[model samples]
Target: MSDSTTLVYKKKKKKFKIFPLVNAIFFIIVACLIMIPIYRVIISSIDANTSYNFVWLPSKFTWGGYTAVLTRSSLYTPFLISVVTTIIGTFVGLLVVTLGGYVLIQWEMPGRNFFAYMLLFTMIFDGGMIPKYLVIKQLGLMNTLWAVILPMSINVYNLVLMRNFFEGIPESLFEAAQIDGCSPMGIFFKIVLPLSKAALASIGLMFAVSFWNDYTNFKLYITKNKLFNFQIQLRNMVIDSDIPVDDAVNQETIGNAATIIAILPFMIIYPFCQKYFVQGVNVGAVKE
Candidate 1:
């Protein structure tokens, strides 16, 4: 074959690959699977007709379910408690992870390898529920908001992600800060922390969502309903048959409405941080 013809044939063969199409098809199917359940919940939430409709769309729509959930005073307290605990937990978790990440990347820090190995060890094998409970009880944190906040304070995976991002920062910057008479603490607070916002934001979002959705902690450590967070409260409403029926909608409709309410905040907030989240995840994902 002529060289020009061979090049064109080769280019054509390279351009027409099945991988992209296969990937696209796979994602589309997965997307449909995810969306269908969400769609059903939404439809069911708004449907107040009190009749079973297996159709794609609801025959009638009403806001009774939403009103039923929103007007309840019991739901309001847990919502506020969740907001407080999530904010506190996310801030504390992020702070600890960021500092730990910084320390992990420091070559001269003594026992760094040992600590890193210990961190990894916890991720692989944790003290079981009974042990954790005993520790909490010993700390006198049981039945308090701190019980939930402190146990999940630092996720090892997030710490590792932050460490990876810190490793990617230029060593020259740290050296320059030291030359300017800046202590390691000052460098971390001013230079390192400021530069690590992308990783911090990404991990912060993860921590916030985790703290927001934590029901097991509340169920296990917190017996007092007044101290419960929104998810735990919602769990009780759903499973305990304790939801008030005096509202316009039935129990099932209210549960669907509660589900949407619970998930709506994350859905609304995710798009705003999505770019930073993706950037952080990708930036730390590789190493030289």
Candidate 2:
């Protein structure tokens, strides 16, 4: 090649080496590294005892684990309980957080900063388990689904994210709505909310994941076996080895399967909202 052509090729190569392509490759590598264990868990769940040893690939695959856990496992009741709790908790928590966040951002209500600071304080410092338990007891919520939902209804960090999103909306739109004699509630429902779909979906998914993965609350307040969440059931399965096996329950493989099943919903839902999640994170990271 001519010297000039060689020099031009070297310049282009240098520019390519400095591009974000390197960072993207690095990110993919790190992501795959993190996901390997999760992938293994899913694989293990689909296979039977062939996975007992540390083989990288399963020699045989079966639906036994899923069938065992979903149909015949003793913990099926708890799985149902978890589904109910997650649904109820996510719905209630999302409504409360979004509505409260919207109000706090909009009204400039008296003592708003104090309330916000108090909420932020909770993020840093928690009432210890005992105190929180006592309060739940005092409220007569123990052994009830409300016990799970009420104490954690509004996460301060999530509220802050939602507030930032609300703040990002054009104030002029709100003003125009006000001139049309729209009430705060009407404006929130009709105008602000439609525009804030991305933020809401992101926050809702976060809350759903939190509620789904939570075992501590259920373990603490729900003494009744019927009230145990899926995490609690999985914990019990992992701890006890001699659990009964029926025609549908492959007791030997249920733990691994349960772990996979527990995480599958989040895996399915996250991709759909991933764009919104990134946007929400970037927007929330910036202080208004």
Candidate 3:
């Protein structure tokens, strides 16, 4: 066919689908619904008024929430604690998972099947909270930040996903590395690690989120008020009603501020890692 005729045929073949267009509009509405509350909270942080309202644009804007939380409330120390723990936990957890996943995919490792079974076993079973508490107490981790970071550094589900991704890699690449006098560690760092960015970003973000939002662990294991994370303090104020009755300060406003502080890092981090997240989630979801 002539090029002009082919182009005309292709244009004729394209038809607008009402269902897809309607579906997209429906989801867009739902997305806006989900985002409205978050937008309100962000705006409320700078709003001077204590009462929540439906006003998209306030008559007067003030930095009262930010100022109150930062200057008066006990949020600063806990903010620092959360930042430190999240960074450390994410790095340590990623390293452990990446190497562990690489090893699980290796056919020559001794007791590889047995170890994989054991790892999978833990995913299905639980040690219970009492046993976990006892272990932490015995290790002198109580009231310490390590109490939270150590227990959940390696999530089994994330490890499994990482393994599935590594298994998808071509075995010939490993053989080529071996032929080039590359050690197992060298191959992992030089080849496997570089190629596994999607899985790493996905798992790393999971670890960071878990670490950042861990209030129950801190409440259970950490008694020292100074060591509490942002989530822990926020839980105390919002859930436990630990807010003191003070005429000068509004607890509700402070709670809203705390909510923003707790979730802002996640909001910022997701956009950067979202592309990798979608790809990584799909990598292990299908079987060829």
Q: For candidate 1, report its TM-score.
A: 0.92
- Tens digits of per-residue lDDT for model 3, 1-288: 999999999989978789999999999999999999988877666555656666686445765655566664577788889999999989888888887888898888899999999999999898999999999999999988888998888687888889898888888898999999999999998999888888888888889999998878998899888998888777776666665534444666667777897788899989999999988876555533
RMSD of 3: 3.2
Runs in model 1 with CA error above 4 Å? Answer: 1-14, 50-54, 246-248
Q: Model 2 over residues 1-288: C-alpha lDDT tens digits?
A: 999999999987854465588889999999999988777777677666534555566656678877666664666777777778778877887788788788778555898888888888989998898999999999998899889887767677878878887887878888999999999999999997888778878787878888888888988899987788778877776667545564543554677777788888888988988988877776445443
- Model 2 per-residue lDDT at 65: 77
Judged by whole-model lDDT over C-alpha atoms, candidate 2 comes out at 0.78
| TM-scores, all models, native as reference | 0.92, 0.84, 0.86
Ranking by lDDT, best first?
Answer: 1, 3, 2
At residue 245, candidate 2 shows an lDDT of: 60
What local distance difference test score does each model get? 0.87, 0.78, 0.82
Instruction: Return the top candidate by lDDT.
Output: 1
Model 1 residue 219 distance off true place after TM-score fit, in angstroms: 0.9
RMSD of 2: 4.0
Residue 167 C-alpha lDDT in model 2:
81
Q: Could you give candidate 1's per-residue lDDT for residues 197-217 as a string of tens digits? A: 788889999999999999899
